[model samples]
Target: MPARAHKRFVLSDQPKKPVATAGGTFRGDAASFYLPDFCDSRAAFAIVLIAELTAIVLSIARQSAAVGFWGELARAALFLLWVGLVSAALLCWLRPRLARLGVGPGSVAALALLTLVVAAISACVSLLGHSRLVASAGTGAYFPRQLWPFVARNTVIGFVISAVALRYFYVTYQWRRNIEMRAAARVHALQARIRPHFLFNSMNTIASLTRSDPALAEQAVQDLADLFRASLSDRHQTITLAEELSIARTYQRVEQLRLGERLRVHWDVRGLPPDARVPGLMLQPLLENAIYHGIEPRPQGGTVTVTGERTAQLISLVVRNPLGERQAEREGNRVALANIRERLALLYGARALVKAGRFDEEYIVTLRFPYIASAPPAGGTRPAHAAPGSPEQ
Candidate 1:
């Protein structure tokens, strides 16, 4: 019995471009002074936990100097809690603006200013609380003498802690940015290798068709041009799903001309949003692999089935092709698969998956990733063609 399949298609009116978020505010417009937010929920939680632990340790160390150990512990806990709450509130209120201030000299100045503000506020609160306690104990307030020391100590500690935390976050942010750049450079190199190999094979196909079928060769050349045009375009920017599929189809057409009666393709795309963005050239390599490994070795070509499905949480694509009588898997296959896997890892981290295996005499590759809608370009206009001088071209 034949394998059952379903087909669906939904066209999009307008497809927006994807904005890369890996490097945060580090990429482009360096003249601007905005830096990305230094603290996420996890980082904030870690900061609070560390501060509390430090406070606890200090309180325990100074227990012999206090009237009672339990009383000292309670006082330490209260003081730390107050500090944590105030610091969190200040960060939540100011971090957004700081992010807009760009990571430059101006940003450093802003951070210093923020540190002073937080230190001043914490010192004032500490002095007020201490004065109230002194009054309640029937002792005249040590308004200037004792209170000044307490306030100055708290202020210095707050400034130092804030400076340290900010420095840690900035270092972490730079490390993450460096990782992303390295990954992107690796992917670009892999893509460069793949494009030349593809071009050589395509030229061979076009050469074979030139004499036997002039008109067909002309059409093939046009298709090749279009394919290369898109390939040469900005690869760092993601293209919409609709645009990607269109390129894939064009590539299939080019391959069909060379394979003739042997190559067959079936596309079953349903319920997928038009604005879904995927890495440029992502599908082409998979399809190339399908043709090279699954169909080329056999005298008679096999059918390549492409399926796409989208849900609220995820988008999935599957490509299946019949395996030949003999398996001729080579290092190139592994390299290509690894390349795709690395790209997926860099792009979506753990949220994206690429699985390839042989099942029931068919080679199948499935790609699953989180669903994210692309946002419209700044000018509200889409480019008609890929830019010239792109790496692929």
Candidate 2:
């Protein structure tokens, strides 16, 4: 049988691009639709703190009644604290239900209802205190007149404040979503530019192999087809560590056929978890850099060592290649490195790290990211090219 006939190519014809969720948040089920709005606890805390501080400052400035500055500050702080706590509690309770309604009139209505409830509770507490004082002073008749105005004032203030807070959050979310979209677009463009260069090189390698070793050449074509199929898929989607390593190995095989005895690869990926998820094409570019700069330049090619280490919270990968004399003088390595860094930032925010540097005669690139497992497909089968056991060294 021809090598092509023996090899199976389970390639996706047209993979849809991954759709980014609004505000860079993850998509949740219907029950938790509103959770993304509350995902940023730091932002929520900051908003609450600023609002409380503003209220305190305003109260101090408007003090013409009977209270001293310190006394007024204390009162204002206590009231605002109570209001903030109550609002947070209600939001926590209502968030999931509101999320199901989405960011629409229904969600806004829910927020308004919460504010009214808080205002009513505050007014009721104040009225009870006032009634006791009026009865003690033999002026219980004034309680009804005082109660209405107090309730009205609290209701108005509560509604206005809540409206403003919700608006601010909405605007901030939109701004962030815009920024993420722009960053994703730039990353996509960079990936596109990098692909042509990679394709041209791979084609050349296969062209050479075809004239010399037909069977290896056929296998290289299959590997190239599989690699391109993946690259053509959703650029924003993630893949498992096992799948990524499989692709890298296929790429290595293609390169080895071209460079023959000049190129060597040493993979030390045993410590890495196979199920850990990473952005697609993340490792392949680094390997390409290793071959282009590290191996191709030297008359006697050097080995590219890929090592991975996994801890409780983090997954770390290190790629080390000899700094060939010619590679030291190259100019385009920054493009690929920067692309990887930006993708990492988009996917994991501050939780991911990509650092590259030189140590003596070796060029090293290290990537560290929070460990996230890939979800299995419907069939529970491994992804294409991903084998069950440890990868071939």
Per-residue error for 124 in candidate 2, Å, reads: 31
Error in Å for residue 238 of model 2: 1.1
The C-alpha stretches of model 2 lying farther than 4 A from their native spots are: 1-179, 182-195, 326-331, 383-393
- lDDT for every model? 0.64, 0.68
What TM-score, over all chains together, does every model reach?
0.54, 0.56
Clashes of each: 6, 1
- The best candidate in terms of TM-score: 2
Find the 10 residues in a row with the least total lDDT in model 1.
1-10
Backbone clash pairs for candidate 2 read 34-99
**lDDT tens per residue, model 1, 1-393:** 001100100010012213223222332243222333325677577657876787679767887443456666666665666666666666666665655554554447556765666566556655665676766875332222355676667677767776776666656655665566556646754554445666788899889888988899899999899888877776657787777777888899998887878999988774555567687777877788888888888887889999887766688889998997777755666666656555554566555667777899998888888767678678775543222111111
Look at candidate 1 and tell me the lDDT of residue 2. Answer: 9
Please give me the total number of clashing residue pairs in predicted model 1.
6
